[model samples]
Target: MTSPPPDAFANPQKLRRGLSRIWHATGYSLQGLRAGWGETAFRQEALAAIVLVPLAVYVGRDWVQIALLAGSVVLVMIVELLNTAIEAAIDRIGPERHELSGRAKDMGSAAVLLALLLAVGIWTAAIVQRFAA
Candidate 1:
């Protein structure tokens, strides 16, 4: 029987090339977000923060509070990106229906939900404090 191609397994050079491709893909993803004007729900939350940022500054809130609010917005985006990755990975593994794939996607969604809750909590506290004062 004939042997398969030697390049079937990745060598160091191939691994390096793969890593480079991954880097470029990450850059593309950023560009996509920018091009889309961050229209995703996660991006909308970021936009909301952008709008509130100036207001927060005008109100002269403490640095800690501002940091918390900004951090929460970032957290939502990060979690969403991770969720997208998880869903993509699952799909790549197998496009067919499977319990594990469903569970993985569901878990990723749950993580995003938790991040959203955190963002809401921060926004509510900051807005209430700014208005109350």
Candidate 2:
């Protein structure tokens, strides 16, 4: 594969090496989770995930099915986090309205909606297969 552009390689954050990089990255990821908890929508999805992940284990008959079920639940939370990130970035840009900012936020919201729908479909199918068969 082609190497990243020189400018990309020049990122100052990339200077960290080895275990220091991994430890710092883990801390940063935790910080992001804390930030995500501050968003109401993300908090709600996280709470739902707490319940649904275990349900997925119960509902699924095999490892593949379990992974698909659990992954779908996590996917909704992932989308919600991304949507929250987009909104936070736009908000940080300033409170003033702009067409592009509005559109970006709208698209992010749409992504979360789609992820939720997909999760619902997957879970519903799994449930039906488990009980309705």
lDDT per prediction? 0.75, 0.90
Tell me the tens digit of each residue's lDDT in model 1 across 1-133. Answer: 6554577475433333477968977887887567445447656766876876665565438888877777777788778777877886898898799998999999999999999898788788778888887
Residue 83, model 1: lDDT of 82
All candidates: TM-score = 0.67, 0.90
* Pairs of residues clashing in candidate 1: none
Worst 10 residues of 2 by lDDT: 1-10
Root-mean-square deviation of candidate 2: 3.3
lDDT of 2 at 28: 92
State the lDDT of candidate 2 residue by residue for 16-66, as single tens digits. Answer: 769998999999999999999998888998898899999888999999999
Best by TM-score: 2
Show model 2 residue runs off by greater than 4 Å: 1-11
